[model samples]
Target: MPISSDHRQYWQTNLRYLAILLTVWFLVSFGCGILFVDALNHYRIGGAKLGFWFAQQGSIYVFVLLIFIYVYLMNRLDTKHGVNE
Candidate 1:
């Protein structure tokens, strides 16, 4: 059977959110940690290197934050599609 338009749209929305969040995570983890590490290293925070901090600790915090953001966003999406639990 063919998928309903609403169902298709819902999946699309989910994918869109996933793509956005993943992009942000990637930018934060890889971009900041590696690409801009040298630039960031010019500045110091609490005597620690900014880029190293991002590579080791900041990315982890951002990941955990993204998890909650994903949960919240998916809940809203579910409600919008009348599929909320």
Candidate 2:
């Protein structure tokens, strides 16, 4: 099935957002959690290990947050572009 121009634009916008968000996600999760973890471990947060928390739990929470952010932004974009469904 062929998509209309409106749908194509909508999909393009969504893809752009997805790409940018995923890139940031990977940077935070892999870069901060694993690559820079040793440096981060030197700092402690509220008696908890910062690096360890980020590696084990923080990344997942951030990813979930990103999901919500994406949904909200997409909804706004859809409305702005008259693509709401």
Q: Which candidate number maximizes lDDT?
A: 1
The alpha-carbon lDDT assigned to residue 33 of candidate 1 equals 95
Stretches off by above 4 angstroms in model 2 are 1-5
Report the C-alpha displacement of residue 41, candidate 1, in angstroms. Answer: 0.6
Residue-level error in angstroms, candidate 1, position 78 = 0.3
How close to the true structure is residue 27 of candidate 1, measured as C-alpha lDDT? 98
lDDT of 2 at 53: 80
Q: What TM value does model 2 have?
A: 0.82
Q: How accurate is candidate 2 locally (lDDT)?
A: 0.88
Encode model 1's per-residue lDDT on 4-85: one tens digit a residue.
9999999999999999999999999999899999998988777889998898888999999999999999999999999999
Estimate every model's Cα lDDT from 0 to 1: 0.95, 0.88
- Per-residue CA lDDT of model 2 for 1-85, tens digit only, reads 9889888888898999999999989978998799989998999877767887888888898899999999999999889878689
